[model samples]
Each structure stands twice: as structure tokens, then as C-alpha cells.
Target chain A: MKNIWTIAKREYDNYFASPLAYVIAAGLLFLLGGIFLIILQGSIQQAIFGGGTPVDIGFINQWFYYLLLWTVPALTMRLISDENRTGTLELLLTAPVRDFELVIGKWLGSFLYILSVIGVSFIFAIVANYLAEPGIDQVKMMSSYLGLILIAGALLALGTGISALFNNQIAAFFVTLALFIVLWLLIGIPASFFPSNPAIGDVFRYLQIGNHYESTFNAGVLYLSDVIYFLSLIAIGLFTGVTAVDSRRWR
Target chain B: MIRVTDLTKDYGPRRALHSLSFEARQGEIIGFLGPNGAGKTTTMRILTGYMPPTSGEAIVAGYNVMEESIEVRKRVGYLPETVPLYNEMVVQDFLKFMAELRHIPNPEESVADALNMVGMTERAKGYIGNLSKGMRQRIGLAQALIHRPEVLILDEPSIGLDPGQVVELRKIIREIGRERTVLLSTHILSEAQQICDRVIIINKGKIVVEDTPENLQARLVGGERVVLRVRGDAAELSAKIEQVKGVQRLKSNPDGSLEFEYLPGHDVRPEVAKIITNGGYEMLEMKTLSLSLEDIFLELTKEQVVTPKKKRRL
Candidate 1:
């Protein structure tokens, strides 16, 4: 556990040790702020004219989540790829730390960075709270944040695994971006392709990140299945990550 | 102490280490000498548990490298050929992290102790990227020493250093090897001859010879040699050199030098010097050319190339 934290702390500190943190923070804040203002104008006009809710909750979730698909790949792409490229992976692997510790520690480092980036997006939420006529749904907002965190964990895990697959961080970033884009595009396609067969239909729908979050958590009901689904995705991603790292031991 | 028995490794169709067996006892510095592709790094990687052997076994500090890897890793400190380090980290911060990774109890003391041992205490606050290659290598040694492992495995530790830095790092390595067992691999035979208590020379993934540097040199070239530079005619000097007692063979070099190979158990230098002057050849330089580890390395590895018809001695 100490070794894991030690690794995580160094990895986390590395983010700030370069200009990467500032770049990521600035991009997320700038983009989120622009989207926030547009949403604010739309919601304000609706509130004044038709007695609508203060913020368009659905639009915010969709836009913020779409930004995440790219922002995450940019952040997590270097987690393992940098180590491999610089030969530090040899140092880390030969240390006394276990395989799981290394995988978890790097994922933890990226997870914290992602959470911070996600944290910056909350400036819009705080601003909306003061301006909303009848404040936004707090429980629903919390659920959406929870959903985002869970899915972000899943995405970072996938990124960590993909990072392990390549020595070049650019290759890792582009590959991860392509993967997330494909998965996001396939989210709603299953419903159009498959008729109402609950077993196979639910399988495809549950596999999609947008399906679970948009249908359940974004609407504020924390269904057990949805939570389980996200957890399982996290597990699969990390399991694949551990396998990729451990393969080095054999060679 | 470490022991390897019949350790072998193969990368697809190519063999890297072929039935290699060697040992280093307590306080012994064993030099793993070989050409670049001669399995020196492969053997170290297997011994340090970076990669498992395809067959056979390696035991380090009494723990098996394959079955008890974590135990072996805890007892060993490795400085890889590349000297891998985090360029973003401060020297002290990096050492602290390594200490924590190794679970040292007194982290601050250990870090300071390692820094002082490598003479890098003054540079602890500096980032690794800011340090010179020599300083970074010293910090690399410091990180390896942070935990005070029982065994030290350094692969090509002197590579990419200035000659002055090479001498400095060799001094540091000698100091560290006083108490712990140290194993280092290098293609430079002089580096091994300078510091190693025992030398293992390998070629084509096979151990060709293993002995002390002096003993290996003696075994490979039993005859004594002397090279002389004279101002007079080469043929006349070669004739005079030929007449010296115990002279087995005399060859005249193209650039007016004389090479003499003499019988063993003989002091031929004084006799050759006297004979050259008596012939009125005005000897400018006369030096006994004692065989070296480099000579033995070339002879043994060269033998491997000429015998294509011979079967590999498995």
C-alpha cells in the first residue's frame, strides 16, 4: 500500500511538474465556461417566458460528457507510455512492488487528474445555483456527477490499458480517442438494429456508457444495475490493464 | 551471494543465454565480460528477475529468481544499462520515493545516506534533467543504494561517461563492493581487469572462459612477447632479436619495429635490450608486451568464428 501511494504521489506530482496540468486545466475551464454561458442564456429565456427549470440539465450532461471523451484520452495517454518510452518501466517492474500496485497506482494518478478536470467543470454548476429561479435538482445533479465519476474511472482504466499497449504516447492518445469515439457512436445504435428482445437488447444497451448514465443516473435514480454495470466496466478495464502489464514478466 | 545453474533464454528462434552457470560469493565483485550480443545483459535480466529464464534457475541472496521473485527483488539493487530515471524528479525526492518503495524504516536517513555515499548530497535539490550525465549516473547509483540491498547488479555502469567520470564511478563502485556482493557486465575488458575479482567471458550466448584476469591472460597466451622500436634497419634488428636466447619466434613489423615471442619461464627483456644495442641498432623503445584480458577475449571469441564445421559444445 505504501509503495502504491508512493508511486501514485510521484505520478500525480509529475502532472504539475510540467506544463501539462496548466494546459489541461485551461482547456477544460475555457470550453466548459463557453458551454455554460450558452446553456445559461437558453435556460434564462425559458424561465422568463414559459416557467421552465433554471438550467437545461440534459443539455449540460450531453455536452460535458462529449468533451470528456476527448479530454480523458489527452490526460491518461502518458500514464504508462511515458514510462515505457523512457525505459523507466524497466525500473518500475524490477522493483518490489506487485503488478496490481503498479496498475492501480497509475490509474489512481490519472483518476485524480480527471477528477480535478471534472472539478473545474463545476464552476458552471456553482454559477447556475445563484442565478436559477427555483434552484436546480440537487439530488439529480449529484447523481449526474456520480455517473460522470464512475464512467470516467472506466474511461481512464481503458486509457491506462491502451497506454500500456504502446511505447509512444501519441499513438496511445490517438488510439484511445478512436476507441471512445466508436463506443460512444455505438451507444444508441443497438436499439435501432435489434427488436424488443430484452436479454440481447439489454446486454448491448448496458454495455454503452451513454445508455446507463443518460437513462438512469442523469435522470437522478441510482439504480443498482446501473451502478453494477459501471463497476463491472471498471473491473474489465483494469483486468485487461493488469494482463497487459503482467505480460512483460513472461518475456 | 548468488548462483545461476544452466540458465538459458531464447527470443523466438534466437538464443540469448545458453546454459550459463556462474557464482559470486559474499564481498566478491564478479565482472560479466562479453561482447555486446554475448548474453551479458540477458543473464543480468534473468538474475534480477526482469525476465524469467526459458529453462534452468537463478538464485540470488538465497532466494530463487523465478519462484521467489519478490524476495529476490527486495535483496537486489540493479542499475540497468540505460540508467533509467524520472527526469522531472529532484534527486532527494527520487531517493525518498525509492526508499518508500523499498519500505525502508528511516526514509530520511536512508535517502541522505545514499546521497552521501554517491557524493551527491549537495545536488539533492536539483532535478534529474538539470544534472550532468555523470551526476545522473551517480544519482542512479544512489537510488540503487537507498535500500542497502545485499547484492548489487550493475550493467555497463560506466557506459557513456567521460574517461574521468569513468574513473570516478569505478572508485565509487569499488567502495560499495567492499561489503556487498557486486556483479557488473561490460564489453571493456580493462574495466573488468581493474576491479573484478573474477571475470566471466562469454560469446555467442555461451560462457567461453571464467577465471581471474591475470590467470585468463596466462592461459590464453602462455608465451612472453616484447615489442621494440629501433632507429636502425629492421632486418638487421630482427636478425639480432632472433639470436637472443629463449626466443621462440621473431617477426619484423612493417614500420621498423621488432616483435619477439619467447619461451615461458624466462626473463628475455634484459637480454633483448642488450642484444639490440650491441647490434648498433640504437633501440628507441623497448617494452615487454604482457598478455591482457583483452587479448584472451579476442583469441577465445575469434576461435568461435573460424570453426564453422565444429559442433557447438552444449
Candidate 2:
């Protein structure tokens, strides 16, 4: 545990010291803020003219979900790939710490960096509340943040696992992006095509991390099943990452 | 203490190490001498537990490398050929982090001691990336020494250093060798001769020879070879020198000097001096050529001869 923290602290500090962290943070904040303002303004004009809510609750949740799918990869692209490229992976692997500790340490480091980006996006949530006449539901707003955290956590884990599989950062990034799109977006299409087979549909839906994410964020309800789904994905992703590193030692 | 028995490593079809076996007793500074691509780094990696050997076992401090890797890692400090460092970390921060990774009991003291030992205490706050290569190498050494392990395995530790830094590093290694078993690999024969108590020369992944520097030189001293400078016709001197019974080979140099390779147990210099004087030639100077470690290394590893299986026979 101490070694894990030591590794995590160094990784976290490295993020702040490098330019990638600032670039990702600034990019995510600007994109999220711009979209939020556009949605809120369009919705306000509709409400005053009595045309109903222009920005549907479902659409807002979907936007946050899709935003996370892109952001997670950016945050985790360097988690293991950079270490291997710079030769620090050998240093970490040969240390007295276990493989599990290294995986968890790097995962937590990526999570914290992603969390900072999410934290910056909260300014847009605040602007939405202030612009609305009746104000937004604080419960739903908080639930949306929770959902974003869960999605980022699971996606970051997946990205970390993929990063450990390759030595090139760009290759890891592209592979992770492809995996995320296939599992999260393409699964939904397959599920619709095979609606008659409930088991196949269920499998596709289970693979779509966003499917469970929407239930918690759109309805503003935190269910134990949704929590378990995200946690289990994270655990499996981390387990796979550690196994990849262990296999690399032998190779 | 370290023991490797018939260690071998294969990267698919290409073999990196082949049936290597040796032992390093406690408090002995052993130099792993080999040319480039001689499997020095591969053997160090296996001993450090960074990678496992294909079909052999290594025991470090009583812990089996394959069965008790964690224990082996805990007791062994390793520095790879390329020093692995986080560029963003300051020297002190990096050393402290390494201490914690090695599970040292008091990381703060360990970091301080390591920095002091490597003479980097003043630059502890400087970022690793901004430092020069020699300083970075020192930081790498400091990290390896942070845990105060019982054994130190260094692969080309003094590589890329200027002469001054190399001397400083050699001094540090010699000081550290008093307490811990130090196994360093290098192609520089002089560095090994200066600091290593015993040298193990490897060629093509096999131990070609192992002995103390003095013993290795003495073993290779089979004949008395001398270069004699005389003011006369070199051909005439060579013919007269060949007339001596113990003079095995004589070569007349283009610069009017005769070189002699006398047989073992023979000192024909006095007889040659008498001949040169009797022939009215000036016997200007004659000196015996001493065998250097480089000569011993070249003699042992340049050919593929079967070394006689005698323990310290010299």
C-alpha cells in the first residue's frame, strides 16, 4: 500500500509537470462550457416563447456520456505507454511492489487527472443553474456529475489496460478509442438488431458502459446495480492491465 | 552471496544467454567482463528479477530467483545498462520514491544516505531531466543504493562518463564493495582491474576465465618476451639471437630493433647482450614487456579454447 501511494504520488506530480495535463484540462473545459451555454440559451428562448424544453434531459445526459468517452482516453494514453517508452517500466516492475499495486497506483493517478477535468466542467453546471428562472434540480445535477465520474473511471481503466498492451502511446490511444467505440456505441446497434434474442440483447447492453450510466444520470437515481456494474468494469480492467504487465516481464 | 547455475535465456529462436554459471561470495567485488553482445545485461536482468531465465536458477542472499522473487528483489539492488529515471522528478524526490518502492523502513534517512554517498546532496532538489548525463548516472546509482541491499548488480555503470566522473564512480564502488557484494559488467579492462577483486571474463555467453587480476596475469606469463634496441644491422642481430638455444622466435624490426620471444623458464637477455657486444653492436636498451589485463582478457576470450577445469591452479 505504501509503495502504491509512492508510485501514485510520483505519477500525479508528473501529470502536473507535463504539458499534456494542462492541454487536456483546458480542452475539456472549453468544449463542455461551450456546449452547455449553447444548450442553456436555446432552452431559455424556447421556454419564454412557450415551445417546451429545447434541450431534452436525455440529450444533456448523452452529451456528458459522449464527452467522457473521448476524455478518458486522452487522460490515460500515457499511463503505461510512456513508462515503457522512457524505460521506467523496468524500474517499477523490478521494485519490491506487486503488480496489483502498480496497476492501482497508475489507475488512481489517471482518475485524479480526469476528476480535475470534471471538476472544471462544474462551472458550466453552475452557469446553467443561474441562467434558469426556476433553477436546475440540484439532485439531478449532482447525479450527472456522479455518472460522469463512473464513466470516466471505467473508460480510464480500459484505456490503462490497452496502454499496457502497447509500447507506443499513439497506438495505445487509437486502440483504446476503437475499443471504446465498439463496446459502447456499436453494441447498442447490435442490441437493436437482435431484440428478439433477449440474452444477446442483454450481453450487448452489458458491454455498453453508457447503458448503465444513463439509468443513474437520466433518472437521477443511484442504484446498487449501476454502481456494481461500474465497479466491476473497473476491477476487470485493472486486473487485465496487471496481467499484461506481468506477461511483458516474461516476454 | 550470489549463485547462478546453468542459466540460459532465449528470445524465441535467438539465444541471449547460454548455460552460464558462476558464484560471487559475500564482500567480493567481482567484475563481469565481456565484450558488447556478450549477455552481460541479460544475466544482470535475471539476477535482479526483472526477467526470468528460461531454464536455470539463481540464488541471491538465500532466496531463489524463480521461487522467491520478491525476497530476491528485496535483497538485490540493480542498475540496468540504461538508467531508468523519471525526468520530472527531482533527485531527492526520485530517491525517496525508490526507497519507498523498495519498502525501506525509514525512507527519509535512506534517501539522505544515498544522496550523500553519490555526492549529489547539493543537487538533490534539481530536476533529473535538467541534469547532465553524469549527474543523472549518479542519481541512478543513488536510487539503486537507497535500500542498502546486500548485493549490487550494475551493468556498465560508468558508461558515458568523462574521465573524472569515472574515477569518482570507481571510488564510490570500491568503498561500497567493502560491505556488499558488487557485481559490475564492463568492457573496460582497466576499470575492472582497478576495483574488482576477481574478474570473470565471458565470451559468447559462456564463462571463459575467472581469476584475480594478479593470478590471471601470472597464468598468462608463459614466456619471457623482450624488445631489445641495438645500434647495428637488425638482421645480423636477429641471426645471432636465433643461435641461442632458448630464443624461440626472433623478428628484426624495420627500425633496427630485434624482438625476442624466449621459451618458458629461460632468460636469454644476458646471452643476447654478450652477443651484441661481442659483435661490436651497441646494446642500447632492453626491457621486459609486462602483461596487462587487456592482454590477459584478449588471450582468454579471443579464441574458443576449452579452459582446463582446475580451481585456482595458478
* Index of the highest-lDDT prediction: 1
lDDT string, candidate 1, A1-251, tens digits: 87778888888888889897888778767877777778787777655654566464545766678778888888888888888889888787778988888888998887887787778777677777667766577788889888988888888888888888888999999999988887787765776666866677767666777877887888887888888877887787678778877887686
Candidate 2 structure quality by residue, lDDT tens digits, A10-108: 778888988988987787667666677678767676546543432333345467678767767777888998888998888877778788899889998
In CAPRI terms, where does candidate 2 land? medium
The weakest ten consecutive residues by lDDT in model 2 chain B span B305-314
Chain A TM-score of each candidate structure, as shown: 0.90, 0.87
Model 1, which residues run further than 4 Å from truth?
Answer: A42-58, A187-191, A195-202, B228-258, B267-287, B303-314
DockQ for all models: 0.76, 0.71
TM-score per candidate, chains pooled: 0.89, 0.88
Candidate 1 CAPRI classification by DockQ: medium
